[model samples]
Target: MPGWEDRARIGWGPGAAPTTTVQVEACPAASAPAAWSVYTGGTWVASPACVPLVIRSEGQQVEVRLAIGAACGENN
Candidate 1:
């Protein structure tokens, strides 16, 4: 299991275009699996990837769903 709280950081680098650069960081654990993707027209797609989920579109908006599972030990 994770700690008392989970954290997420969103930022863009200096000297970079705002829309062109985005950063996401999760605390305790750096990344999680991207559970799904949502686009316009109420469309939903299954997208699975390790996080710091990055979008490269200039002005397109998207909804990303993420699932962070608890950290399990040898106890099962």
Candidate 2:
């Protein structure tokens, strides 16, 4: 924990300029979301809306949840 302070970064707060103006899509995109590493802060990024993808295979229904949006990781 010696270098914790040096490694820490602050994120944007709610209602802040960065947080207040992210326009999310009314409908999520059909494409899958990409994986990003742990945020290092300095910027607000939530876009390319994504939705749950359900796959029905062999009488089994599997839901694939991908965190594409920074808001809650999903459109809904």
Tens-digit lDDT track of model 1 for 23-65:
4333333376645432222111133222233353556756343
TM-score of each: 0.22, 0.26
Off by over 4 Å in 2: 1-47, 69-76
Q: Candidate 1's error at 54, in angstroms?
A: 8.2
Candidate 1 local lDDT, residue 65: 36
**Residue pairs with clashing backbones, model 2:** none
After superposition, the stretches of candidate 1 with alpha carbons farther than 4 Å from their true spots are 1-6, 10-56, 70-76
Q: In lDDT terms, which candidate is top?
A: 2
Please give, for residues 1-76, the per-residue lDDT of candidate 2 as tens digits. 1222232222433433432222222333447575443323233323333334354555776765434442344355
Clashing pairs in 1: none
Q: In model 1, how large is the Cα lDDT of residue 29?
A: 34
State candidate 2's TM-score.
0.26
